[model samples]
Target: MPIRFTQSCPTCGRRVQIRASLIGYTVACQHCNAEFVAEASIDDGSGTTDSPIGVEKIAVDPLMARVEEALQRAAKERTAVN
Candidate 1:
């Protein structure tokens, strides 16, 4: 079976499964037809290059998260004050 990897289409924000063979090649989103380069998923500790790609878990930055929360509170406060 051909290995596949799922990545979100940047234009339409839909998950797209790309053939493993097409990695590093240009491919279009099946749903939106947006063209983009195919990227393999982050390694899952298997250390294998041919592993199937799936949803990647992105690590959240604590400082960035705090900043985002602060910004959101500021926005809400500004709206209330106005």
Candidate 2:
């Protein structure tokens, strides 16, 4: 059996399982069609690479965003009143 390691898709945050042989090779995400490299280190599992991963898109809840904005507005108003 081939060894496999797990990583998240930079675009869609989907879980990806890569074969050990494919390390240092370029790969495309099946979920979002985003391209990235199958990078890994043999010494440790820190998952660090010289190249940085790009985030194409991220999903967020509208309600959470509204709540965050409201909190920011409230803080600004409070500061102005003080």
Candidate 3:
């Protein structure tokens, strides 16, 4: 059986299975369209490597989230009225 490792897509955090032979190979995340190296380090599940363009997770602001929720509520109310 071929050795397989699980890694998360840096851009989307989707799990991807990679073969041992593919370690240090370039791969594209189907879910996020982000390209990264397939570093198949099976220990601790990090499995991240150098990417052409660095991918960083963005932090959502609490104020922005509240504003979005308010907007959604208003839109739903308007639709119900219509």
Q: What is the C-alpha RMSD of each candidate to the true structure, in Å?
A: 12.2, 15.6, 14.7
CA deviation > 4 Å runs, candidate 1: 43-82
Off by over 4 Å in 2: 41-82
TM-score of each: 0.51, 0.46, 0.46
* lDDT of each residue in 1-82, candidate 1, tens digit only: 4456677788998889877668778999989899998877665558533443432222145665565578779999999999
For candidate 3, the per-residue lDDT at 9 reads 87
Task: Report the C-alpha displacement of residue 37, candidate 1, in angstroms.
Answer: 0.1
TM-score for candidate 1: 0.51
lDDT by residue (tens digit), candidate 2, 26-60: 88887888988875433244754334322111113
Each prediction's whole-model lDDT (CA): 0.70, 0.62, 0.62
Clash count, predicted structure 1: 0
Using TM-score as the measure, the top candidate is 1
